[model samples]
Target chain A: MSGFSRFTPLVNALPSTIPFVGPEAIERQRDVRVKARIGANESGFGPAPSVLEAIGRTAGETWMYNDPENFELREALALHHGVSRDNIAIGGGIDGLLGEIVRLVVEPGTPVVTSLGGYPTFNYHVNGHGGRLVTVPYVDDREDLEGLLEAARREDAPLVYFANPDNPMGSWWDAESIVAFARALPDRSLLILDEAYCETAPAGSTPSMDALIGQPNVLRMRTFSKAYGLAGARVGYAIGTIGNAQAFDKIRNHFGMARISTAAALAALRDQEYLRDVVGRIAAARERVAAIATENGLRPLPSATNFVAIDCGRDGTHARAIVDGLMEHGVFIRMPGAAPLNRCIRVSVGPEAEMDLFAQALPKVLSAVR
Target chain B: MSGFSRFTPLVNALPSTIPFVGPEAIERQRDVRVKARIGANESGFGPAPSVLEAIGRTAGETWMYNDPENFELREALALHHGVSRDNIAIGGGIDGLLGEIVRLVVEPGTPVVTSLGGYPTFNYHVNGHGGRLVTVPYVDDREDLEGLLEAARREDAPLVYFANPDNPMGSWWDAESIVAFARALPDRSLLILDEAYCETAPAGSTPSMDALIGQPNVLRMRTFSKAYGLAGARVGYAIGTIGNAQAFDKIRNHFGMARISTAAALAALRDQEYLRDVVGRIAAARERVAAIATENGLRPLPSATNFVAIDCGRDGTHARAIVDGLMEHGVFIRMPGAAPLNRCIRVSVGPEAEMDLFAQALPKVLSAVR
Candidate 1:
């Protein structure tokens, strides 16, 4: 049946495209099992066992809505970062928070600056809101800080998105460069510094929370979906000035956090020891993936995040063939959407068994695709 | 530190107000415990044991992102409702879905129609998107449907919201009138038929799925949060035409659903026997609440929902006093926000122990408030 005749023109103009195609969809479409499941940057090593216990214990309480204030989780995040709880705003994930941030700043024809192929979800949000995207392509697989700044100034764009320890390419800028970028943006422009993979980033790669804490124009995004290994839990938060965080209250699904997910996040936060250990495993898995890539004649890019982007030394179509070919062998991985970066395939870290499946499948796919 | 200086005029104009303050926030601010836990329309009786079991089973899989497509859940919902899978769109909850719907239809100063003091979350979403609300006050505690239709026509409103088994008052209209209302709306105006409480409503209170399925302008919302007893799970779906459902893909946080919540919802849907039992219990508890109100010399409104709204026989201030008084006794009942309707205190059905606590505390609190 046809839709309602009068959705706003902005909504009508948007393509019915999704940011990511999940492994479940892949499996259904291809009628093949995804044995490796090392895609989408999910932690196949899974959340800490303690988190599972918390979920089970809290399951019976699933009839209660989560606190709209998100007091406990925000408090825990505050104590962990040595900041005030008022600085944090919880959301479905960085993706959800990005939508709110876009809505808050972007009006129809407003320019929004970001790397050309950084995160499709962020782009999706900007497009959804009728913001004109001013793309700055990557410089050496790292987000082009200077180019983004130039576009913001040129368009007088009120919003700009920058992801440190970037997705797709799995590259990052040093702390100094990132802080400099935030400081460089015009005071009128809001900088959304997406730090979804920050917990896994090398020490010098992530800026200290205190470094940008008081910057009114900057909001740092973090997520449990990464190093915390709770992607399916859908818990992510934005850390910024209290006023910036409070702005989220003006337009958010206030009672939207899933109750058990909140409990799971609380338990996960309390278990810092687990997070530290998982980071070590992720680092090891990154190295393992790099080694596997190198052994199979692909060059794995240096990464500051949980995943590695392997250069296939060809164009988007060749990378697409490798992605499809690997999926045929029950290994699910993704590739960059645009040129240059699309010469690569991205694989997330997981348990050894899944990695082994990828290790076995990659060589065969490469050979067949050739 | 302050927020960014360049938010859109609309965002800058908005007050940072949450639609509903959580009971947890009340406990924190008032230094009281929620003994009865009967506010927020949440099922105090909790989710089915089988749903809890599903959560436990899915805990280990929380490392993976839920299928962005929400394919399985949509398929199950379609099978349950006798609609095609494309007819369903899943979200964090009905609250989240409302936000998306508002985003699609409302622009700055766009007139949207709804009952006065209806679901505040829906109104919250409308205002967030810069839509001007034209609220038609309830007539005799039920939504004035004819008034809403008139307002829709007069304002040429592109969007209107009405809930079946209405919140705050727990009042409802019969199915034929509702279907007629849907059919009579101008094609330019979209109808959001929020049926979040339908599971607890009487058989004829809701229009049959087939009755309005073909109407392009109508979208019916349902939740696992109510009689399915999974409020904290944050699972809700909108049923509409294929094109309408596809529109959600243009802008939704594609990977937003919590993996375990999806599992819990799937299990909840499969366990019809459990849902039937819970509906029976909810009805009995509704009766119990009415009896409690009668015994206290207050009037209880007729309800088609899990909660009963008791007329405290005074103004909003008196109702507020009763709510605050009951909280001092560890009872967490709530009242409507505006005038007239605010004369009532809303109490949700719960286990007998909680009802007994309410039964014990109400008289003393009412006396004190008086």
Candidate 2:
């Protein structure tokens, strides 16, 4: 395919690899409609009724560009976290914010640290910018903090990414340990402490904004995509020092945010009661998913996230077969990309109807795969 | 204000600046509410009722991430343009796509060419990536295409941006001229043919998709923000070669698009009758704005866009005064930023209620400013 041949060498060398194949893509490719929709870690319970109402109320204003400063959302986020508005910066989602942070810090051949099977999207951004990856493998299904810090120091990496209440594995580190990890990193190494799943994590798993607000090298990412049930809204924010927050203004697409999405996020933030309710429901669903996995003769990893990782008691291929088999049954789930973690299949929490579909399909899938 | 001290040298040297101050920011800073929001060239007429219905239908699905491939939207856009799906690349908006294209081609010190008073957001993106801009001044109140081609050739610039039915000035080149210019550019020089206002432009002002589709170096950007009245939806697409379209996959935030925004765009595209109706409304509003300018003894430049630029017959200071003066009456409008062009104040097309507000407020604001 012919293209503009003068793209920067970094771009020319990069592959067109997506971080994840969405369920919609699967439906099209396989000609099978997804019945359960339990993949991709989205809340099938959906956004709060109030957020939907807010979207409806604001739909008529769709002709105006969203506020480029994202001032209102930032102010709300700051108030919620008990920080100044200057301490917050908003973006389309954590994925978009990650790209901005990577652009701000990483250059060609710069070393970036992350868990081997960590968030693929971060790695995708780093690689897109020609940042060399120095990955530390997960230790016992959890992001190995000590190993990550060691790698950062050894590589003199300018950027390190850590996810508490991680994706894929659904493992988490407590707030104290996470704080120590951030503090241990060199001041020269900026830490992208991704707390995308924080709302669904155990109480102690996420550090308070105050704990890292003063650390210029630390940027804590939070999103409405998880516990708030607005993943499609694509709203996320980063909490850092005022200077760090302002750094995004240096390059972010000021008018890139969708106005209704901003309204949805603002509404989602105001209704903390809804958030709490959803978090409880997510926890219950995770238990149901775990129970289903165990009954299917699989081991469910302890998860403080909105999903459960089931160890199929076999190798990567076995886990892959289970994932594929379940999708054939219209129960779409995913597995880790790399090994060790790939030996487990990841299942996102959904309503009982979807969970019932999973419950009904798991035994058939396992038997077929076996 | 402290931040990580080791951001990339380019990032370190960059100033934190926004391309445009949104009306909301103006409202906050000036302690006034914008009663007539025509400043940003957003569609004040709002999106079609059908689009609002689509948004409402999909609001619950805001819990899922938008398709990473943007499959359905791309397919719809391709069909609309009579191009293949591979020829279309989706983004948050034209502003977002500009940033991506700049990142793909521009590195530190790479030369870029554009009109001196061209889109500030494009300049912001180029500057953010450390591209040196070579600007050609507009001739006769329109972008001087010949001058732009000359500068691009002289600088060996890899990127050139030209907007037809332009913003701020609302001027345009004929479709023949635009097509010839694209075909004339060196293969190494990528032409960003920004047709953001194409839907509002007169027939034959926009080049046919087939006119430039096969060219690897040309990317024509279009948005649903103008005539479709979905600026807040943040949907835009680039038409180019298959390879050019796929190049975005290397670095774009694949999941960055909001789900409801995509739904809005798809619904809006399917309802071409609404689009035709709105375009006619916009044309009528533009004529009304021009009449208002004439009544106020200002020369209204002919516009093929949703906004009109009126010559204030003075200097930048006078135009600035008019912009600020309108704000005092709760009528928000804008002006071109650079000299020559800055002698004109820009007004956007809106519903008659807002037009009446502008019409009523213009004389008093002008008198006060005088």
Candidate 3:
């Protein structure tokens, strides 16, 4: 059967393509069992045991909708960051929040500036809202903040995206550079300073919450999916000025949060000891992945995130082959979607056992691709 | 600090109003402890023990992202309904799906039809998308199907919303009439036949899935939130043609679902025995609520849902007083937003204890209002 004929012109023009193909889809399409699940930058190290306990305890309360205002979670996030609750807006994840933010600003033909392949999901939202994307290439594998600012100015764009401690390359700019970029951007250009990987970033890499919290044009995005090890819980928040925070109230799915996910996030936040220990383990896993890549004659990029992007010493085709070959051996990993960046393969840190699987498979896959 | 000044005109024009006030918000605002939560139509009888067990088992797996395609859940639902997997599109919940559908069909000034005092969340999405709403008032406390059809045709509205076994009034139309309404609608008007309360509805009241599955102009919204007792899990789906289902991919947050919630839903679907038991409990609780209303000299509306709407034999203000009075007694019951319907108070079914609390509290609350 056909779809309804009356979908808006923008929706009709939008492609049906998804932002990212999940590892599960790959498993089905390739008919391969994913033995090592470290492809999506999700923490295979897992959430705290206390978080699991909270989910179990809250299991019976699954019938009640989460507070539409997300008061408790926002309050917890506020206290954790020393901001007012009004400064935070909770969402399903950074992906969901990006969609809402895009809808708020992007009209048909509006230019939205971002690094060429920063995050496909953000780009997906811009396109979904009929915004024209003005791309800036990565400089030294980090998001080109200066280029993004210039593009925003050139186009008088309302939206510009920069992911500090960037994905698909595991690159970052220090806190000072980031703050300067935020201050340099035109007030008309709303900056999405995505810090999804901030937790795993080096100490001086992320700016203090106070550094840009009062900035009207900047919103910092954070998620529990990465270092918090609760990707499946789908909890993410945006921190900015109170006005920017409540702007989400204008369009967000207010009751979109899952009760169990919220409970898990609260538990995850309360157990900072678990978080500290997990950060350490993620550091170790990164080293382990880098070592495996180095032994396979690949150069591992300096990373401030949970994943390592290894330069395959070849073109995109070769990198693709290695990625496909590794998946054949059940070592599922991802790479950058666009070229220059696609010459590298990205591997996420997981439990030691997954590292072992990747370690075992990489040598053979690299040789086969070579 | 203020928000970015360049939000679209539509966004600036939109109000930041939420659709529903959560019980938590009420408790905070009213400074009262809620001992009975029979206000939001949540199943206080809770999800099956088996669903809880599934959540516990899946807790450790929360670190992994749910399958972005939601292939497993879709396949399960397809099997359950004897439909093609392509017929189903999963979402965070019906609320989330409504937002996506509105984005697809409604643009600025686009006419969208719905019942007056219908699902506020649906209206919320329409307003968020800048769609102009043309609402048809209820006839005899039931949604006026003919009125909605006339409005859709007259306004050339691309979107029309109807909930079967409806909310606020707990009224329903027969399967034949609903099918006829769908068939009679213009092809340009996409009907959102919400079946959130379908499971609790009488068997003949719900049309077979085959009845309208082939209609491109019709989409059925179903939820595990109501009878299946997974409101907090935020699992809902839209059943339509393959084309309509795939349309969601153009704009949805592909990774929005919570992994544990998906697991819980799969477990809930598998435990149909538990579902049958809960349906019976809901029916009995409906009776319990009706009796409480009758004993208090209020008239209970005939219900095809998990809640009963009781007419207080007065105006909206009097009903509002009784509702507020019930809250003071720690019984959280809600009333309709508009007049006529607002003359009735809606009470959701829960466990016997909650019913007992309501039974005991109703007389005092009613007399106090009097």
- The fraction of correct interface contacts reproduced by each prediction comes to 0.96, 0.96, 0.96
Candidate 3 structure quality by residue, lDDT tens digits, B30-139: 89999999999999988999998899888989999999999999999999999999999999889999999999999899999999889999999999988999999999
Please tell me how candidate 2 rates in CAPRI terms. Answer: high
Q: lDDT, candidate 1, residue A145?
A: 91
Predictions' DockQ, in order: 0.88, 0.90, 0.89
Q: Give the alpha carbon lDDT tens digit for every residue of B96-202 in model 1.
A: 99999888888889999999889999988888888999999999999999999999999999999999989989999999999999999999899999999999999
* Cα-based lDDT at residue A328, candidate 2: 91
Q: Find the 10 residues in a row with the least total lDDT in model 1 chain B.
A: B44-53
TM-score for all predictions? 0.99, 0.99, 0.99
Residue-by-residue lDDT tens digits, candidate 2, A1-370: 7999899988888887889999999999999889999888889988889999999999998999999889889888877889999999899899999999999999999999999989999999999999999999999999999999999999999999999889889999999999998998999899999999998888888888889999999999999998888999899999999999999999899998999999999999999898899889999999999999888788999998888999988889998898889899899999898888999999999999999999999999777777
- Cα lDDT, model 1, residue B190: 94
Supply the global lDDT for candidate 1.
0.91
Error of 1 at A232 (Å): 0.4
Give me the runs in candidate 2 sitting further than 4 Å from their true place: none
Point out the higher-scoring one by lDDT: 1 or 3. Answer: 3
Q: Can you tell me the DockQ of model 3?
A: 0.89
* Native contacts recovered by model 2: 0.96
Candidate 2 clash pair list: none
Question: Which 10-residue window in model 2 chain A sums to the lowest lDDT?
Answer: A361-370
What lDDT is reached at residue A312 by model 2?
A: 88
